[model samples]
Target: MKNYFLLLICMILLSCKKENKKNFDESIAAKLYNKAKVFRNSNVSDSAFIYYNLAKNAYLERKDSLGVGKSLVNMAILQHNKQDYYGSIETSLEANNFLRKIDDSTTRSTLASSFNNMGICSSYLYEFENSILFYNQALKYVNIPSNKYLYYNNLGDVLITLGKYPEAQKNLSIALQTKDSLKYATFINNMARAKYYENPNYNPLPEFYKALKIRQDNNDLQGQNSSYATLSIYFFDKDKIKALDYAKKMLEVAVKNNSKEDQLQALQKIINLDKENYLENFKKFQALNDSIQIARSKAKNQFAVVRYDVEKIQREKAEKEIEGLQKNFGIGILLIILIGGLFLYRKRKKRLEQEKELEVKNTQLKMSKKVHDVVANGIYQVMTKIENQEHFNKDEALDELEFVYEKSRDISYEKTDNQGEEKDFSEKISETVSSFKNDEVNTYLAGNDSGTWKHLSTKNKEEVYQIIRELLVNMKKHSKATIVSFRFERENDLIRIFYTDNGIGISGDVIYKNGLSSTVSRIETINGEIIFDTKIEKGLKITISFPAS
Candidate 1:
């Protein structure tokens, strides 16, 4: 009884210790997260990103997926604000892996925020399609009316940029339902702009002025800058004088708000409009643009370095934990290595045997193909000539049979050298076509001279010879034609062969079977294209073209 009580006490102590560690880790994660929020609110983006990344690691250690997701979302937003758009997108995607796809409000809100940040980053990067997709995803997860309005506004703006005026107006109309005065102002301005884009004569100046007025009343300098920029663009072609005034106003608001990107934009408009001080404004634009690029590059590098440092620390901690187990597991690891080596050796031996078997099968297939081409096709050609001709020449038939016998013998020796056979390829093609001619079918050949076969390689000539033979055989069997013509021509670097027969055309789908399948494979091997045109109602036309080289 005493021993049982002692064991129970030990178990209780161990459980409490684990519980304490969990609480401790969770507290650290919460504190780090709160610190990040404080830094972000104070506009110290770098510090906020670092703390959020750290909080993410802490939450990961505690296996708190929600905390990790929230931290990553904040980090992604910080990256976005710093113009590290690609990095922001990557972080936002990582956050999505941790976030739950559930109806829980917090998870849904975080998921929406992550997607919304990705949309904004993609828009900045000029990936309008991806931006639209992300914004739609944000809308899917977002239940809050204000966020929905914001997403719709963003989607509408992107749609307008894409020249989708109707879609822009549709989304903007949805956004216009918002009671928030600032959001309403944004929606109306966008809606007006969409109308103007759809019809250039449509005046959006009144809505632009109204949005500017609301921004001014609310002390929203950023919003006012946007309004001024739009108005400047609206009057840019119509009235340079009015456009110059709006551009100057935009510059003033941008400078007051200390927004370098906005300042650069306003300077560009002013440089184009205010010609009197083009050089001065151009110089300012160049300097500010350079400074912004440099700052953004540094911020991107800083975020990367911070993330790397956190990961490095985590890796070092894991390595230390692993080090203590290595000595104890040394014998077991050695045994596993020995067993694994034997298994791999056996697997490799089996793989080699399988490869040998496959090679043998492939060789058999090649020999079978040689037999079909040299023996079977040769006899069929002879039979076709005997069937077509009234005065069958015994001497010519004997010579053809001897050639087939020799070719069949060469297949056993795997002799692929066809230089002798392909030397007179043009004559061979003429004879093959002539042999197919009979009382029912009239065969004619054009451009089948030796000069036409001069540029083709021996292998290519052989393949072409076989292809013509296969087509003639197929025509003899299937195409009960009265006339067949083969036209061969060389144009530039290409050799083209056109075969036409006034036969009942191949009906339905032309399944590549018999020797037709091998014909295609042979053509492909020579980088050739053979198109069998079965669309003709009365006859069949086959066009074959390939490179002369």
Candidate 2:
């Protein structure tokens, strides 16, 4: 009886001690988290990160995996908010692993959230294939009918970025069906935004008006601001003064939200609609963008600091730890700064180079369109007329031929710059066939009324155009084709370019002569597959299908 009483006293003392410890850790963690919030609210990212690091350490030392995961998720958000995409990816990946190990349903949304974020970052990096993969992964976790809206919206955005328009439209329509307020705003904004580039019917102006009404009623300042920004672009076509007025309204809300990122983003997009005060506007844009980016970076660093502090507090409680932890942190900070500085510098340089290239490409595209409409097609008409006229005198024909030859040579020389880099495929085909086609050939086009080049990339456009030209030349020289029909259409991810002609078909025993050998070589070089459809009187229909990218 005496021994039992002593043992009970010891147990009571230990229990009381543990209770005190738990209370202490919880108090400190919560306080640190709140302080981090205060710092973030004040636009002091560095201090916020310091506090967040402390909270992360506190949760970690307590062996609270759920808390740790949540803390990490917040940190990941901060990192992404700062544009530290690689670091954000790593943080999310780690958090996702923890979430996967946990079976609780309460925080299961973390997995889908992480995947959606990863997909967005991947799209920013232009890794379209991987972006699609991550978006699809998000769908697995967000399959619950109630939770499907945001995931499908995110997936649709990624698909659109991947140039998978049909798939994107399907996903976006489903996302809208859920009518989730935030997701609805986002999906509607994105869908309407696509009208500016890809779709012709739904102008961004009407969609923005509708979205703005909903957002204003809900008091969603961010959505209202974004819609206004988009509206600014839309109305520049009709009312410039109204567009600028709306754009200013957008910047005001972003400022009120205390979201520097949004403020800068809104300002940048809105400036595109501005016509006057160009220099002043550009200076303001650069300064504001830089300041906001710096603030976000500081906030991200603060989150990192908070996590570190929590870890240190825990280590000190458990078996005595070495005191060199802070010293090592100093060294690590310097190294990371140096490395990050170098990475940012290189990334900036690369972006500048890409912008320059894009500018040149846009110029080339404009020139090519002009040439196709004015010069190339005009020459093709002249050639066709000449072939039909059947002129009697050789001398008169020689003068006309000389004029065409000199003009065509000039165009050819201009196109040969950068090894045909500037030539549009349709223009090239028009030029090449005019040079080779006989008078009486009749051409039928199926599905070519889409004005011919809506969906083609410059490279594919050039290649496919060449393919058509080469086939026409081959038929005229050897196959004796009078009538030809060309077809081009898209299905799934593939594009099929096919042509049929009432011409002599090839025998397997005979070696490909004239332009046939060159056509086969070109197709092979492009890694495109060719199917021959030729039977006795059936003539020839060659179809080629290849991956778009």
Candidate 3:
């Protein structure tokens, strides 16, 4: 193949013969960027990742923060596509350093996007805390509030998932606050949901009407369908015929959207409300469910192909380079043989390097699953127990739960050695606190000196993370705090976390009697101290201090 790069260099030099200039080699990198964009649209995630890897390398070589940040965004998406939720969080965190270097508004958008996807990953894994954390983080970077409608909606969804009806409604309300009719319609649909779930007396007919009217006007097929389903549910208790009509409309929309979940849910309602119509919809529901399952697998396969293709291109490019250099060097027969040997050596060296890279990637993949599935999973399980008011001689379950989250935190943060500057630790904290925000409560993380935080070992760092996470969880359940601030402070030889909130604070007497309970033990394990600063109407502030050095 002709080297367009060389031709371009020749042209630039020829055109500017009057003055000498240092030419930049951006051809290979530009190709990577172009290919990645193509693969991303094609939905070939793995191939997309390979292309993104190339782009990342090219941009880094050129010291382009924008390019690097974009590549990281693509990498994170690929990780999510591959079901490596924990891996996506880790990669996004690594992407953060490069992102923080960029001054452009686009970088902010990129960060928001990264956080949005991270939230999805965490949510699917049932790590509600991490999911909410990422959602809140995304909210901050959405420069255009109009672009934040979906984010706020999603935030409300997670809040509902946590069984915090009031909190969910609050978030959904904000989602509609812009007064964009289309957005407001969506929120009404969501609010209908919140009321239904959290309050027995909640009636959604009026809200559902508001949603239906807006969705119908806007031609929002999905939203219209959703409103219909809610209406069906709302009328189910009163009028059977009315419920069936609404249910039929919902089913039609579900079919149009090709949404299995919605279809199944709609059909299930129809069957329950009108058992006489079951025989008809049941067949369609089963078929649709099967079809969507196959679609999911097919999508996964397509993503894998893209990954393979990207690798093939890079290998082909390297082989061509080595072969061309060897054949073009016709200075002497002896030189040709020497050059061929050098080429083979280079090829072998590259192969070894690839092996090392693959090993590192696999290790990361393992750690990610462990962190998300094992540790985050355990946290959710314990949280579920607490939320449902389940039996709590819970010492056995609590002990098992704490063990997993702490261990995952320990292993997942091996590189930082528990340093304050650790991005993973910061992210981990965000993930933990994120789940606690709801109608009645909100969690906010503030004042981290990421640029200045430097000391702490990986173990110590994770220990700090676990301690803070446990404390925050406790505050959310017990503090009755409407507003909570997760503040991180570092001084010479001392690291401190001040979890202050406008909630009911516990007295020091309670702490002495119930100190180091559950998660607090993990904090004590790391030689940490906790103090309660509570006051009337001011809420509660628990200051936790630990050794940074």
Give the distance in Å from residue 336's predicted Cα in candidate 1 to where it truly belongs: 21
State every prediction's TM-score relative to the real structure: 0.56, 0.49, 0.52
Model 2 regions lying over 4 Å from their true place: 1-64, 124-128, 143-147, 194-198, 236-242, 269-273, 319-549
Cα RMSD to the true fold for all candidates: 25.1, 19.0, 11.9
Q: Which candidate number would show the highest TM-score if scored against the true structure?
A: 1
State the lDDT of candidate 3 residue by residue for 172-257, as single tens digits. Answer: 88787776888788877888888877776777678879889988888888888878877776677579899999988888888798
Output candidate 3 Cα RMSD.
11.9
Model 1 worst lDDT window (10 residues): 9-18
User: What's the lDDT for candidate 3?
Assistant: 0.67
Model 2, 197-242: lDDT tens digits are: 4654655666667778889889998888778777776665578788
lDDT of 1 at 238: 83
Stretch of 10 with least lDDT, candidate 3: 13-22
- On lDDT, the leading prediction is 1
Model 1 regions more than 4 Å off:
1-19, 101-103, 316-549
